[model samples]
Target: MARPTVFLIQIFAIFGFLHLGFGAPISLENPLLRQELDKVGELPGQNFVVNFTHYSGYVTVNEDSGRALFYWFFEAVEDSSDKPLVLWLNGGPGCSSIAFGEAIEIGPLLINADGKSLRWNPYSWNEVANVLFLDSPVGVGFSYSNTSSDLMNNGDKRTAEDSLVFLLKWLERFPQFKGRDFYITGESYGGHYIPQLSQAIVRNNLLSKEKSINLKGYMVGNALFDDHYDHVGVFEFLWSTGLISDQTFKQLNQVCANQSFVHPSESCDEVLEMVDKEIGNIDPYSIFTPPCSDLSSNRLRSRMHRIGRVGERYDPCTEKHAVAYFNLPEVQQALHVDPKYAPSKWDTCSDFVNLNWKDSAGSVLDIYRELIQAGLRIWVFSGDTDSILPITSTRYSIDALNLPVIGHWRAWYDNDQVGGWIQEYEGLNLVSVRGAGHEVPLHKPKQALQLIKAFLAGNALPALQLHSDT
Candidate 1:
């Protein structure tokens, strides 16, 4: 069933955008979105000097509603001006990219245990690309909207539209990045953000030559592409990993049939409760890692509800550092965060936005088809140990596309050791990271760096040999 969506039309009207029927983003006024004004002079607890410059500020997406999306842009570590620009998003549809993308995963700095200092990420993606991390929608991180209704109304369409508008305005602030090779990368729900935004860029690029965005390609890891496939993958991962019994597995398939993603049935919830009790406190996001034993059910429930089971953090209490660090007045001041905003404290994920997400396209596979056909460099990867959105789910979703096998399954290398397995499809490549969980870089930073290098260079992951099965 198609969504009764007039969101694009509504947004077009809001921005006075000419409806090209493909969500084209034209330059619009952003009174606060200016160049150099948003630059970060120094952080609250930084001890080391750096060559690259970075900025943190908001780009007003909707003037009528006062919706501004926050962003943290980091120039490349070396040859800063020459590198490609990579926009990173971390998805909960409501998660903070500044928290996950910038602080925890790919960003240059990691919050210290003291929650006041920072350490450099040796394998930060900025080594090769200028990375931009955004806190999208109105309610996530420092991004906010004055209208209360905006908080309750956000869904996929609005999020994508706002993000495209953000990029349009953002490029104006950093015109040096205007025609650079651009790529978007993220994990989990970013699965939706990257493709949808890519489609918008591709379609809008057709309207004008001077304003076109130079989008080269994009990638996602352990992403949520399709709900049906995801649900199937979850139950199967649970059973295969011995987290649930055989009988319970059968019950999950039966009682949970046709129930997937955010829309779960009553019977499915009941089944999940049983599975939850069986799984206990172990982190479902990474079965091998220890769970964050400190967080309350209130703060942790967002992920728990993602796959019908309780999940803890990949890094035990790592977000506490980010939460503590980002919420400080000094840090906020340094980042150019506007003081007046709803929900005063900073959090990694927004439960309000998650609960009220009004509309979500169930699958991005079709969007992938369109982008793939358009010759966009597309790649999907999985952190295999992530039972939350497992490798199995990625596999099932990719298989559903029925794309031609470009290369047989092969072992990809990092430092001559088997980092993971990879298989290439007609336009998409799927790679799995061994011993990695939902946050691939956090668990396997070196390998993650290698993966990014391959994807960005339009080169394949270094391989041992093709598998005999193909």
Candidate 2:
């Protein structure tokens, strides 16, 4: 299935819910959402349902076609006195925020190993600021659209626009949040997601005062910011780590430095070819490699079976147990998804193919440049172990930006132990989490949280300085 088609399926599902009052009251009782929240334990001094009641659902973005568009999920705790509103999106160009919400970071709950129960994350982001996790672009998670055509081609532009609409309406729904400090945050492709959406918010704010949205800053973890540098860095990392032989490394370096490096398509081809030739000889667990054709097929089948088995009970984008637990009939009825599709799987990263997107605007670098020029704060972070988009690539990509350095490179320490390295350039902050792979939060939660907290506070995290070893 094409990217657009996959998106359409999500839109159709969302619209079906909208027809049912956008699953409003029922969503409060949604089995999946409620179960996850319940497991996390109730707020410090408040009833569980009372805290959940702060969340409201309605069509945030309405197309000219009159189809009601809705985004569902919980709201961040706010004093209604003073606090910043932070909007969060998870990548996949198709993943839902709920994955990040319930499992990692901060929501009200955490899914257990069994995937059926939840527990509260005492250190959830809400402890500091109000956070909003959104299922976006119509077909992701609980957010949906009535018209298939309304589904974006899954490009950066459309995703940004749709998110903007959701943000505007979300603000309207909670008028108390207006004039409050606001920010955008996400992971993975969200590196691109948050910036694009922030730029759009800035543009709309500049055009009409009444329609303006206040966007403070943005943050991304293990983000895919620049394709050119990111790709080259991946190979360089492989070479440095001895994943590729001296001969293969030399060949790759020559072509990358001279030819393919400047061209994304050529570079991608070269990298894939090199990976194909050497992957079998290398340790799969040690270095991150793209999905080989054979492995890709197996992974695809597994994903499909997982998705098919879950049906509509829950999203099947994450892992298997996650699907079963979140899809229980009790969970579905509470989440407000049709009970018929109840007990279905929930995919945080499903391989729904019908909706592959092909019309994304230029490379991520192009979008990053646009956002920076538009005066939005951009942050790109990486987990060093991630072979898919390793720290080496992220470093190389940022180096190519040629932006003025606001802060020199420094080591990030944890409990007095060296944790990672970070640098600040103009309005953009770049950092690498030591000992972490693709998922920074999952692998290094404390470090990840500390870095984020400092970023949000608009202060520099402690810099790593060279240590003298005698």
Best by TM-score: 1
Per-residue lDDT tens digits for candidate 2, residues 51-100, read 53334233547666433333334455556346577777776656666665
Give lDDT tens digits, candidate 1, residues 226-247. Answer: 8888878888999999999998
**Ten-residue stretch with the least lDDT total in model 1:** 304-313
Computed on alpha carbons, the lDDT of every model, listed in order, comes to 0.81, 0.57
Instruction: Please report the candidate that would top lDDT against the real structure.
Output: 1
Superposition error at 443 for model 2 (Å): 1.0
The C-alpha stretches of model 1 lying farther than 4 A from their native spots are 1-33, 209-211, 296-315, 464-470
Model 2 regions more than 4 Å off: 1-60, 63-81, 149-152, 210-212, 246-277, 280-318, 338-345, 353-355, 463-470
